[model samples]
Target: MKIAVCGFVMGIANLIPGVSGSTIAVIMNIYERLLNAISAFAKLKPSKEDTTFLFYLGVGIVTAIFAGSLLVSLALKAIPVVTYALFLGLVLGSLSTIIKRVNKVKPTYIAAGV
Candidate 1:
């Protein structure tokens, strides 16, 4: 269920200009898993189970993207402000969540870089 919802959200993000579905996935906490799966495929000897799982997951994501793009494009054309407002809220909320997860006052880490 969670995957489905995230896929739908990514689908909607991809439909909007200036919004990246990959960015949305990153903000939503699914990017690492998705990237890992992709990287696994890049290996010469990927497991059959992993390959099958990725195949199904890819189908679900593609289906969601197709449906979301069609519906959102029509709705945005009819109500631009509302659609923009909703997307803005999503992005801002995601940003706040990301910030909250960050550690503050890492002077040692900063000094190591310098």
Candidate 2:
């Protein structure tokens, strides 16, 4: 269920300009988990349980991307303003979560680049 939701979020994110699907995954707190699951595929003796879970998760993500992209494309063609507005709202909402997660910058950190 969680993976499906993340897939949906990622699918929508990819449809929006200036919004990265990877960034959405990061904001959703599943970035590392997703990466780890993909990396595990390279192992010689990969865990059977993990493989099975990843298989289903991958399917969900693929399905979401296919369905979401089609819906978004159609929505943009039929209602450009409303479609773009909804995407803007989603990006803004997700950005707030990302901003909160960022560490506060210290004077030294800022000065280092200058």
Candidate 3:
């Protein structure tokens, strides 16, 4: 139940430019699990847990993407500049959330430049 809500919010975040879906997943504490689930797709068979989680998350994300697009379109028609400004704010504000999710910074990671 809760995971679905989190996924939904992540979906919305993805719709907003500059607001990374992975950043929201990290904030929701599902980034590692989500990454693992996605990455496992290359294998012949993935675990049931990964498949189930991805299924629910995928559904939530797809639904939210469609709904959010419509909402954004309406908002743009009503107030284009304000809607874009709001998205800008959302992206800027999300930086703090992203920072919190950064547990550590190592030399290796720095070298990787990610």
Q: What's the best-to-worst order under lDDT?
A: 3, 2, 1
Off by over 4 Å in 1: 1-5, 17-19, 105-114
Q: Candidate 2, which segments miss by more than 4 Å at Cα?
A: 43-45, 106-114
Which runs of model 3 end up more than 4 angstroms from their true locations?
A: 103-114
In candidate 3, residue 26 scores what lDDT? 76
Question: TM-scores, in order shown?
Answer: 0.69, 0.74, 0.81
TM-score of 2: 0.74
Instruction: Give the alpha carbon lDDT tens digit for every residue of 1-114 in model 1.
Output: 566667667776777665677877778787887777778878756677557656655665787788887888887899989988987886677656655666883878557635
Highest lDDT, which number? Answer: 3
Q: Give the winner by TM-score.
A: 3
What are the RMSDs of all candidates, in order? 4.6, 3.6, 3.0
Clashes of 3: 0
lDDT of 2 by residue, 32-104 (tens): 8777776777665557766765665566677777888899889999999998898788778877777677698
